[model samples]
Target: MDLGIIGQAAGLFAVTNIDDILILALFFARGAGHPGSTRRIVLGQYLGFTAILAVAVAAAFGATFLPESAVPYLGLLPLALGLKAARQAWKSHRNGAGDQEDTRAEPGGGPGALEVAAVTFANGGDNIGVYVPVFATAGIGGMTAYAVVFLVLVAVWCFAGRFFATRPVVARALARWGHVLLPLVLIGIGLLILVEGGAFGL
Candidate 1:
């Protein structure tokens, strides 16, 4: 394994994925008391990231698995999720559930793995754009090396998110405001993705 390739892969992954830390932290905060939440979150992240990589690799090889024009529309995934979360929060507040609702077990264990994966993939539009060119230039060996490093780094990223969410002050704050902020954050990210990608010509 060439050190240069390893370094380049690490740099690319770091640049593309720095934003993921906050998103993952919010997820951990939301799922703090739930059993198996950590596993689900991590699994979802890998699933989503793997999908992104697959698409990038396919694109790099001149395979038209996903049209470039459709990339921006991926924002819809997070947008819909945000709207759903917001509606649920509003109903909970209207019903006076308040803080108690925060710890309530969701119907399917508080955000299924697929739900998390959707958000992860939605947030990765830029990752796909950046990765395609690099993957195109890298041969088989190089691509394999990059993939291994990327997967390892995903675990590190998850650990960092979990660590941040577990902090005393951060946890308290998230416990209080996570429900409110989660929807807003997801909405904001969705809009940003749409606008940045020029989705719907916005």
Candidate 2:
């Protein structure tokens, strides 16, 4: 196994899925004190993420049929997404809303595993956009490595979310920094993809 490829896979997963931590934290927060809520949340997360990966993998397989020269154009997806996220963050900051906590009311009952899975899948639009191009570019071995790393990281993300449920301070910090960090990392990844792919002669 190539350590460099593993590191790249880890980095890709980290940047693309950073926003999930906040959502997971919220889910864990709401599910607290409900019987078996934790189990359901984790299971739902896995189910949803697996579905997302399946779609990405399938799409990537299709992407492989595209002209090699055109494949690099897929980098535009992440670049656009990063710019959009950055714009939103800037707007929120200008409106003095960047630091505001999520104040949405918790649902009446613990969300079932399927319900959580739905939400997770719903939130994965960006994931698909990013994953498809990356997976298409990665060969089978590299893609397998990425998949394994992603699955392992899902557990870590779940643990972090659960921990943040009990630690509002840490969660708040994540919220504050995440807005700043997410866009930067995404943009960087976008550029890396484009440059490495020699997109537009860059």
Worst 10 residues of 1 by lDDT: 100-109
Which candidate number maximizes TM-score? 1
TM-score, every prediction: 0.93, 0.61
Candidate 2 residues lying further than 4 Å off, grouped into runs, are 63-109, 168-202
The top-ranked prediction according to lDDT is 1
Tens-digit lDDT track for model 2 on 1-202?
7898889888988897787786677667646656688899999989988987887888899843335575555556556655876786687677675233332223444546875675565456457778888888998988898899998999999998889867878656645576665556556656766787798899
Clashes of each: 0, 0
